[model samples]
Target: MRLIFIIVVATSLMPISAAPAQAAPLDVKGGYYHFIGDEGGDVDVTAQAAVLRNMEALTQYRSIADGSTFPGWQKEWINNLGPGVDRNFVLELNYYGAGEPTIPRPQTVDGVVVPAPDMTIQQRPGDTWKWAYGYRQVTSGQVDPLLKRALDQLKTMPYAETVNIQLGSEFDTDHEFGTTENGIAHGWAASDARALTAVQYIIGYFRSHGLPAGVTFSIGMGGWHRASFRRMHPEWLRGDVQVLQWNAYNHGTPRTPYQVFNRTRAWAIEDLPRWRTKEVVIAEWGTTANVGNQAVWIAGAGAAIKRINTDGRGFRIGTLTYYDNDPNWGELMDRDAGLEALRSVYTARPFIG
Candidate 1:
């Protein structure tokens, strides 16, 4: 049966604790938008602020990995935007070896460098190192104090009501350095053992501290790896943990927009059944092709969003935060068509009351 429910923007919905029933229809009119750039500092900041001024939520990636550099002007924008702006501010934290400080050292099993106890292969070059250290530290529930300090800083911010802390992204992808079997020789596992431990600790910390009503823990979606890994290990399927945030982009290969959309949507749908408890959010979704196809990507993504929301049975599809025009990934908003399509959705449904 098709479930036709309201798409309430997270900013608008009452706290999950208070709203036992399903959320009211989501007002997609003004959800979050991001500005991701490695450089081009102030110019990028101004442009981002202009766009987000009209949005209901805004999430910014200050640094790629765990590095300490935040956009100098981001604080200014947040401060000036004020609480009345109604935009939720989210800081993307790549705790699992993807970003900063890098993982301390590799894991050793039986005197040989072995994959960490509970992690998958690494997708990026240095990712293995990060996973190895993160797994060792996080799994033992040893990273609580550090995480608490970081979360505490974020919580004190004025507009930090809704926070999306993305733990290890694409835990299933073999491309990541630490998740691969060969990388495992260097110390990292394919099971996310350490990350999960860290996540539990984070949830408890937030709850105990009473940060806010909407603070949540989101696990990055393992899009491509879901089907591939399931085939390899049928017994590994456990329907306990919720795979929250997903990172999807429309690029690579010769696939048409429709084909890309189908492939992307399939990834989420297949994993929904395995996730019995938590909700899903397309935390990061966009197209990286040149400026021309931006509109096509947005349109295709919007259709996919509609489909997922309507038919997402066991999982509740939460937010679809689009990627912005930037260096690492091509600009998503350069094309007027793409911007218009996104704006239409954002304005059609206002996320906040």
Candidate 2:
């Protein structure tokens, strides 16, 4: 009688959550993905993963950014997560900073070397730093020289499989185009338009090279911001966007906040579908500070990445990158065990087969 009772109770309890899912292999047609940032899972495979390196040529100069300290500055992971690299891991093509930042070292024109301060180099939200100062140079045609230099260097490096630009985190820091009050997702901001034009040039540049054969630009928003943009910029929703992502940085209180449970309900169910992006993802999400327990929370978030039913084709979530802050912000994984969560997710991250 006791055994029967115990067995019945165990079976009666329902599963709290499902294990995190991985993305499907993306083709020209586009389908399911698994960089499940919504659930805090990722698809970073060091060998097969796409790591963004700094364009040394650009950062070598200091005016654009302190070549020695800022820009591609790499840092130690919270738990010494995978291939220990510093904070300088952004996909920013270096060598373009014949003046201050990025790589590939462009050639001189008219005996002058200046990294056009107009071209924008985007970073995650709430931070300061950019590719250029404003659209002043972009419209002046100064970006042409820098663009030429960038194209030259990109050709020599390892081919980037997908260049995913998860938009919306551009929450107006001191960067050039981002300085305006217009929300990053506003879409009508002049600076935003210039950035779009620049990105189009970048896509055109790469497509001409045959490396990626195509280019993908991604954008994301949190529940709060998503509502604002949807009402303000209804036209922002379109079929052109290849990768649509979501931000899941559940922050505030206790330094590092526990996410998963809330995210499953928020990102998976509410936010993703409301945005109607072709590919759904939690582009950036992680707990801040807290050491010993970070691993569990991070992994839990991954496991909790629940899938939602939609009308479009079925697909997995895309990458869920752990947001690592360089320059040692108190909230970052500077010297703690928080990285274990990040490592576990990537280690067990799903593949696109």
Candidate 3:
């Protein structure tokens, strides 16, 4: 489930070729996590993409159930981008959140149906949030039709020159999608195993059916939560998956670029072994309206990334995108300060293949 309230926003992977004596220079791409126009907002998708040309952008291909259908706005959003655009499209295949895995007599808030807990995954110790789940059905082949339809839809999209299909958003965060069965909460380790299996299955399914030339697939989580999962299950970062992705936000007290991206820098340079060999993406990152130094943070964000790319660190920190197009959070509208801050980064370090 994508964080619709506090949000941010994959690809078929290239085979991991044997490492060259000296890897190519890191090219850190820039873009946003969501496009407002696609969500019935006033912004124009084409115009927005044009401004951030040659960068990576994000949108969702959502499904609420095993057989849930694509919404009207999804097709319109794809059509708006058209063909021959220089941007990379990251179509997040989001499933089951906020009124999903339906249970009896769900409560409604603000005229919206509250989603029932997924009983497939059991709750574990230290779990605080009720939304976490392992997506067992998806990986178990119970929803092949829905997954296939999403791939087919992307294949027909003229705008998807380079597509990255992220399997689901932030599942590793224990509390966000924990498992439960019949009112009983169980341990989390089993669900964790299930989550990893689901990723492996999704990757194989995509590989077998295939994506377009530049498209690939990956799984994502909160940057803070990923290290724990990776440590316990080293296999999470291995195999056919070529990208290391996570949502990066400055939710703590306001932070400097160095402070904010420092963890990412560590992951690339020291903490995560073999991370240097894969593409690392800060899938979602931004400052809040009250952060005071939004422009500075925004500008510093890009500069920090650029420094990593050029510092001869052998790190592949590609794609530093913001949360969204709304003004309330890390908005990047025409008049917003974040837009210029990001544009400067894109201008200085142009997007490359």
Which has the greatest TM-score?
3
Off by over 4 Å in 1: 1-25, 29-37, 40-54, 62-76, 79-133, 173-175, 179-191, 227-243, 254-271, 274-279, 290-292, 312-316, 325-330, 333-337, 349-353
lDDT of 1: 0.45
lDDT of each: 0.45, 0.37, 0.53
Better of 1 and 3 by TM-score: 3
* lDDT string, candidate 1, 1-353, tens digits: 12323435543576756763323235432344544334542232335435444454444443122322222233566545556443322332233323233443333322434232233345566533332334454445444444454555666655555455554444555333434222444323434443455545555665677656655555554455554423322223233222355555665553444354345455545644455345555555666765346665565544444454445354444555665656345365455565676665555432322
* Candidate 2, superposed: residue stretches over 4 Å from native: 1-133, 162-194, 205-211, 219-224, 227-240, 253-277, 280-283, 290-292, 308-316, 326-336, 347-353
Off by over 4 Å in 3: 1-27, 34-44, 50-56, 59-61, 64-74, 79-134, 159-161, 174-177, 181-189, 229-233, 268-271, 325-329, 332-335, 350-353
Candidate 2 residue 313 Cα shift, in angstroms, is 10
Model 3: per-residue Cα lDDT at residue 21: 21
Tens-place lDDT per residue, model 3, 46-113, is 55556666445544434423232232233465455544322333332332323433332233333544
Tell me how candidate 2 scores on lDDT.
Answer: 0.37
TM-score for each candidate, following the candidate numbering: 0.62, 0.51, 0.70
For each candidate, how many residue pairs have backbone atoms clashing (under 3 Å)? 49, 41, 20
What's the C-alpha lDDT at position 121 in model 2?
A: 45
